[model samples]
Target: MFNDGAFAQITKRDKRDAMLINLVHGEPIRFGVDNERGVAMDSSGRIELVDVVDVGVENLLVHDETADDPSVAFAISRLATAPTMPTPVGVFRAVERTEYAAAVSDQVDAVTASQGAGTLEGLFASRPTWTVS
Candidate 1:
């Protein structure tokens, strides 16, 4: 029981909202106001927006050393013979990017120990170089 114009308007709103979401990572400013009383400079010599309150955390990185493991446990599901329903065969734990990087570094070290230095560099298709005139 929906009209064409209403559907088009909703679609346009959704598209605009999605585009805005992609542009802004966190919260978006809904409104802003400048006090006409007087202009004051901050410590950094910049005019501060006193009316607007801080929305989210300023520091994006979690620096806590004692933070719990962020890795997640997931199961591999497959369709078995008898029943059509999927069955969980194995459970695997995901590792963080740092863990992967460390593993790669260890592998590189092992390769260097047996193959000697600069072997990995030679394996690459192109080597970066800068010439100063």
Candidate 2:
């Protein structure tokens, strides 16, 4: 019930303020907002995170073959997968530019090591706002 022609047309849309994204990371991937799944920028300049979207079929990547080299494969893979999503949805960091989960975990490990006690764990665990929702 989907149109290949219409799907390919996904690339033609505007790409201003495009955020660099990667679920399949090699280099920072440029993703124009096809449509925002849910996250919206608030007046405070803090982006609101609604849900986590992992790197998978459900979080589809929009790419253009004629426009980009690496983009085509990711786009096609997204098209082939079932239950793929449009828009780069999730809590994204402007720095790491990788998948949100990877950025948080990987960067944490890269910065310092986690020891037994009297460590950063206390700082993180003690914070009231740190509890999982």
- The lDDT of model 2 is 0.39
Residue 8 Cα positional deviation in candidate 2, in Å, after optimal superposition: 19
- Count of clashing residue pairs in every prediction: 0, 0
In model 1, which residue pairs have backbone atoms overlapping below 3 Å?
none
Q: Alpha-carbon error at 111 in model 1, in Å?
A: 0.2
TM-score of each: 0.20, 0.18
TM-score of 2: 0.18
- Candidate 1 per-residue lDDT, tens place, 1-133, comes to 8756643422465432221111111222121112111112346543222223332333112122232442211111111122322222222223345687899999999998997887455757455756699
Give a tens-digit lDDT track for model 2, residues 37-126.
233233553333232244332433332223434434433334323323333432222232468898898867766665433567688777
Candidate 1 global lDDT: 0.32
| lDDT against the true structure, each candidate | 0.32, 0.39
List clashing residue pairs in candidate 2.
Answer: none
**Model 2 poorest ten-residue lDDT run:** 20-29
TM-score of 1: 0.20
